[model samples]
Target chain A: MKVAQILKTCTRRAVLAAGLALGSAVSATAEEVFVYNWADYFPPELFDKFTEETGIRVRLDVYQSNEELAAKLQAGGTGYDVIVPGDYMVQQLAQQGLLQEIDFKTLENFPNVEGPLKFPVFDPERLYSAPYLHGSTGISYDSEKVGELEESWSVFFDPDPALSGQIVALDDELEMYKAAAMYLDIDYCTEDPAEATRILELLEAQKPHLLMYSSGGSIERMAAREVPMHHHWANGPFRVREEAPSWRMLFPKEGVNLWADNFAIPVGAQNVEGAKAFINFMLEPENIAAATNFNGYANSIPASRDFIDESVVNDRGIYPGEDIETRYVGNRLCSVEARDLRNRVWTRVRS
Target chain B: MSNRSAHSYLAIGLPLLALAFLFFGPLLAILAASFTERAPNGGIDWSGPVFDAYTALFYTPDLFGELEPNRAFLSAFSRSLYLATCTTLICLVAAIPMAIYISRRSERTKTLLLLLITIPFWANLLARNYAWILILRANGLLDSALQSIWPGFEGTGLLYSETAILIGLVYSFLPFMVLPIFASAERFDWDLVSASRDLGASVSRTYGKVVLPLLTPGILAGSILVFIPSMGNFITPQLLGGGQDFMLGNLIALQFGASRNWAHGAAIAVGLMIGISLVLLCLRRLGPKGPHLSGGA
Candidate 1:
């Protein structure tokens, strides 16, 4: 009886100690800047480095897509310090007044940003959103498997019988829809019902050959030789280079979609000062270059180019020249009607 | 009330209260949302109740008089039902023997076997699904093994197929089916089993007449456990079948995410709930007249 009573007392004390420790830990983390971003979009070590430099610790949450980020914010009271949004999403958020204007004067590295990125159509004034990384959707393939394929988008749309069950397109409604519309020589964002019908018909025709619907994962799949050809993003070659050096990405003769991911402080961000410091830290040349190296995407910091890998710099797929740039089209904020129609069609395609 | 009566009330009342708060409270909220119109950009429309979303579940009723059938919705619903039936059937085939074998084992061996069944649960479901992808992709382990065996055989790996999806569903839900049936098997009257065998009955007749009636409650419980989740599952199909084989879960996810139609999503969710209840009612009607057990997995 005496031993059991003593053991119970010890257990009670241990529980109290643990509860106190957990309470303090929660309070300690409350001082941190909470950054919400895309999954695998940055090296996690960067946050540790930031904490090492600054007194403030950083907390991270990741999301898979911009739609998810938007939905979370729209739901209200997200408690996020900073969020990353793609260009079209930024436009939507800014229009809704869900974003805060960034004070560029506080950041010493603001001038290091490229002139083109500073003038994105979403935030033309560059007040609400800061550019992070940019890339374009195109074709990436295992050269070992695919040989002498056509340079046109038809290679993916109307694929060779040999390439059937080996091709993948982005599962995203807009990206693949744009690719299909561009391949048909129709406007990428046309409102015409006939063009929409044509796009749906095109998607249906291509459905049998596609191995999967995916936004990313093509690089690893290519490395694994699970997929021979992918209607994928330009940044994929850089990612797959180390693992599968034979993998190559190309700009199709048909136009490709250009996209930029940017940083935005939501309206109710609790740690504006910490968020600004974090953003400034990320904009620094070495830090931005580190992000680019880790993610295999192009950073907006122009001065960071000197620190980029030689292969990434040399690859035409990663940094397309003027010829390819002229062919790239960016998406605008889509009307709900058009979005709904496309979703309905996509549902049909998948089902 | 007297202390004995009060204690009995406390025993039942606490669990009922928890059930009401945890399950029915949120279900009611979703039910309310299903009646409201969807806001312009995916939020709830608080203006008023609207039955339009519920009607839209089966028909467009738009400018175009295309009321023949909502092909997308119908296909997704039918596929979900088909997949669920397949998963339940497969689980029944696999779990019945597993449960029986485990029940007949020595206590220590039975514990070990049960532990082995539960071992898969220790690993995360998503991680397990990803591991499946590695084993089943092109030139993956299965393909290579086949290639080595038959030099002329061209190997087609099973990723992004109905077969892969079924494998995932069966592998994940088999344990659920096993546990409940094992409980039922534990209480199985051995004397009756022997008498039926000795009586002029064949093996099949012995099972049908003597064993099956008692196993009905367990079989129903296990089927319910396997079928419901499989019917609404998207992850197994998404990762293993590459989101190519869409199901009810994918359709619901689309309504909430891509389609941005929360009202429609909620309506579909509620509709699925009703469908499940109806299915349970039908099953009960077909069930044998016996002492029904309330064991759930």
Candidate 2:
């Protein structure tokens, strides 16, 4: 009867308000989960399916960047039941006591997780987070324009004369600096000013060739033939493939930064039970496969592979070979000193 | 008298409370945060007051605590000032004739022309900026249109340059300049112009000496409105200028967003506010008094 009452209030409120912008009054007695994740990450119909099956009303909000999500949680009282933070952020949030232990190992679908993803460097014991989607950052270029270039960072760092004013890179400091560091064979988390200066020099040289440094509109911009080469992520090429079949995404010889987004409940979540149920539901092979098919990113659940779209599963951009797998290295949680150096380098590069 | 005083207090008290809560509250918080240090985890460390953030604007501390002269933020600030100044000057030159022309029209025509000026505002600013990209990019609409006229012509590719940013800024803020000058020009007396001409004054002298002095107040107000916002604008530069160079607003955003140095961001904001306030004070002192416009009435 009590469970029924909770479901009744949740569904009734969901019908009235579409389960959005109302998180406070019914929070004490409702079976509702608020999901905050990256933009364009989840299929819209998946939420309805989730609510239908579990009777736990799902409300979704999206954020543009990991820092924004961290900032919101840091400000406190977000009323968010579940948050999707990237790899290093999970460790940071867990260390700051902003995340509660989820004991994901006890979950029924724990066995579905990929072996390597089970003990991620960020959350070794699966204590505070569950792996959601995983991907890597690399170059996505129009082969027709670039004309058979080597699969190396040099294509971006030392752009050809023909490619001048037709290349672009991400505006993010971390991703940009990481790519530079990899190209220069320097440490990504180096606090050394000399090393940072070297990275800055490389970026400054590339700056003139770049049309812009933007993180948004990669797919649309590429589709419109705005740039021949765009520093992009794995999922970007898949989305761009339909529009620009001549374009190709590649991992450079140096390396690429591998990232994993994980689902973790914040400390003061209103409906932890509902949040847990949602996470468990998402862990299902069929459900997460739908997310992969929709967003064109790989999920951590290995069993979901069979359910993935053939175009995505077979795409080299999404699933690179074993030899190139070594190039997908995990990102480091840079020290405060190192982060300061990186920020200064970015400012100088932009200036 | 006591009842009147009580009513006056009630009238002023509510607005004052609202101002304090809405304006001063956040302003004071930012001011306080500017003087604080950054925690290890990228948020403000409110343990104590420090000038590290302000110092960081000019000098970056090395591993040994020695300060290195940093020109990054200084360059961004100067670039923002340069762009804003250019936008204001261009807008002033372009808006004066347009405003004067609008003010001289029939009453209904004047209203219609002003309506036409504001029709662009009905569309979203972001969408308009994106449209500018479509027009300004290489081999884009402009190039295609030009190519139709001259088959061999190639586009210079204006899209991601400072020129494009200037074009976007001037286009966005021109109405701010026009409306204020129009308001002043609408009140101009035609008799002064005829009197100057009757006295055998040259056309240039009559216009320069009579028309310019009366429009100072409107020009000052318009300049302030256009210059201040354009100086701190990040979107136009990010979209049109390709974000290769960081403007003042973009630099502040970098400090807050990726840099995760809220104190530094707050410090830059406070510094920008102070700089703009000083500029406004100078402009006020330089502007003609209300009596300068009395001849118009």
Candidate 3:
């Protein structure tokens, strides 16, 4: 009830209590690591294995969106030992002073993490976060219904009235606004009022022909052929393709929005030792491979290729290519005022 | 005497205090936040009360030009009112006759009918909505059934349309409309109907004059129950309507969550409360006789 409001004012007390809680929790024979991550993010077996080996119970909580996670952490009293934030969000949290510095000396397996994740821009020296999964957001469509569909954001932006009620764009403001900006050849994170108007018009044009704006549920409808084409997130499109093989994911010529989710410890984490142990265990090649195979996202562990699911390993949609570096778009974490302006326009898109 | 007074105080005062702290307390906070200034980091500024957020609802701030009223918020408000009225009307019409029929049933049959009406409530709301999606979508239940009959027939896509949103709304609110109306109908004076018929009133006239008027209080209450919630319900439109739908509830949620504007979200919520209150005030005129014998035998 009133707990949400109380939590906001309880920040200092929670921080002090959690700071004291850390040492006591570690000195205990068995401790509970308060792990918080995305809903359906990791394999259940991973937690069970960690608990069995280390005698530390994994008390996990799931968040559906980064915004929701940010809200809880911002309010404080979350009492989480570990939190997995998306790439941009990790830096966002770090900048907000909400995350603790990662102690790499405690994690021996940190060197095994390679590729773009090694010296990730979000944490250049790997001090704040480590990559959990990397994937690209793009177009996922039914091949049989729309034969020879081009790899373009135009399918979502320049909708055909003939294809009315069969197209969907993601409901995410930050992500889909990027697609709209890319489609119109404009900066996604602009503060210009005229640019906001243009983006609004672009989205409004798609509304008549648009089926729905969704975050995660668009995949279910697309897989069921309820929607012929959807502006989809990377991992969802890959998972949906497995169910409906005729479904294909396309990264446009304008390029794609690649997401890298990372594992980070929040400030005032109560079970730091247990959290570090869990993270180190997760960083192992076999354990990381288990995550990739089960969750259908590419992990950063270099030798994970050997243990990853064969279908996922060979699939073009899952592993686009080695040259994903050229496709990377810098995630510009927009300032609050800029985001407010964009969101004002976004409300117009919904209407 | 003082001890007994203290006992009564504990009995009433404690619960009321708890309720105020738990429910009304938070509601007051939200109402307060609606008038407050937004901090740069998206928290309430708490410096002083400001009408800027309320004005922001209807007008955009402009430095170089005069501010214009926000058309998007107005349009979304109108759309929510329109959809809520539509869902209420459809539910009202379908519920009345069904309630009457159920009320006229034998005791065993009446229980069965009421139970059947409420079976949907047992399932999670989201899962029940998903079941409708599976039933109504292209190549889904209805589509496959049609295909079996016609052989290779492609079905029309319905899941993400306004039509689907209405269907889902009507399905959801049907029982809410029925139970109250059924209770009002079940205890009706059958002798009055006989007297009307015996007095040589025409069959249509007897029902129109006598039966319909008696159900008005229940129908009115049911409509209020259905309409108020439907105005704010974004999930039905989101899931069944394919996220193509934007209701007032989703708009408020967007402000708080993705938009990260607490002051604006609170303003929108206050707007919704005012709208619902206006509608509720209007419904009081329709239900002047008040709900009848709901708690009685």
C-alpha TM-score for every candidate: 0.89, 0.93, 0.88
Rank by lDDT, highest first: 2, 1, 3
lDDT of 2 by residue, A1-351 (tens): 011223334455465455444433444454778888876677767887986787777777667678888889989998999999998899888988999898977788877887567888889999998988888899998888878888899989998899887898888888899999999999989978889889988998899889889876667788887788899987776787778888888799899888889999999999998888888888999999998898787888878888999999988877876677788878647888888788778888887
DockQ of each: 0.50, 0.47, 0.39
Model 3: per-residue Cα lDDT over A56-164, one tens digit each: 8777676767777888898898899989998778878888899999755347888888787777777787888777887778887778777676667776678555677
Interface RMSD of each: 8.4, 7.2, 4.3
Candidate 3 residue runs with Cα over 4 Å from true position:
A1-29, A103-107, A159-164, A236-242, B1-18, B61-66, B147-154, B289-297
CA error at residue A175 for candidate 2, angstroms:
0.7
Off by over 4 Å in 1: A1-32, A48-57, A102-108, B1-18, B61-68, B289-297
C-alpha lDDT values of all predictions: 0.79, 0.84, 0.77
What tens-digit string does per-residue lDDT give for candidate 1 at A1-351?
A: 012223334554465446545545755744678888876567756876887688666666667667778889988898899899998899888887899988554467788787567777778877887778888988888888889877788999998899897788777887888888889998755656677778888999999999888654555676676778887778776766778888787777878788999888999999998998888888988888888877778777878988988877777777777788787787678776666566666777878
**Model 1 steric clash pairs:** none
Q: Candidate 2, which segments miss by more than 4 Å at Cα? A: A1-30, B1-14, B62-65, B290-297
RMSD of each candidate relative to the true structure: 7.1, 5.5, 5.7
Candidate 1 lDDT tens digits, B118-176: 99999978768778877888778778888899887677768888899999999889998
Give the alpha carbon lDDT tens digit for every residue of B63-91 in model 3: 22358877667876887888889998998
DockQ agreement of candidate 2 with the native complex: 0.47
lDDT of 2 by residue, B62-122 (tens): 4334788767788999999999999999999998889889999999999999999999999
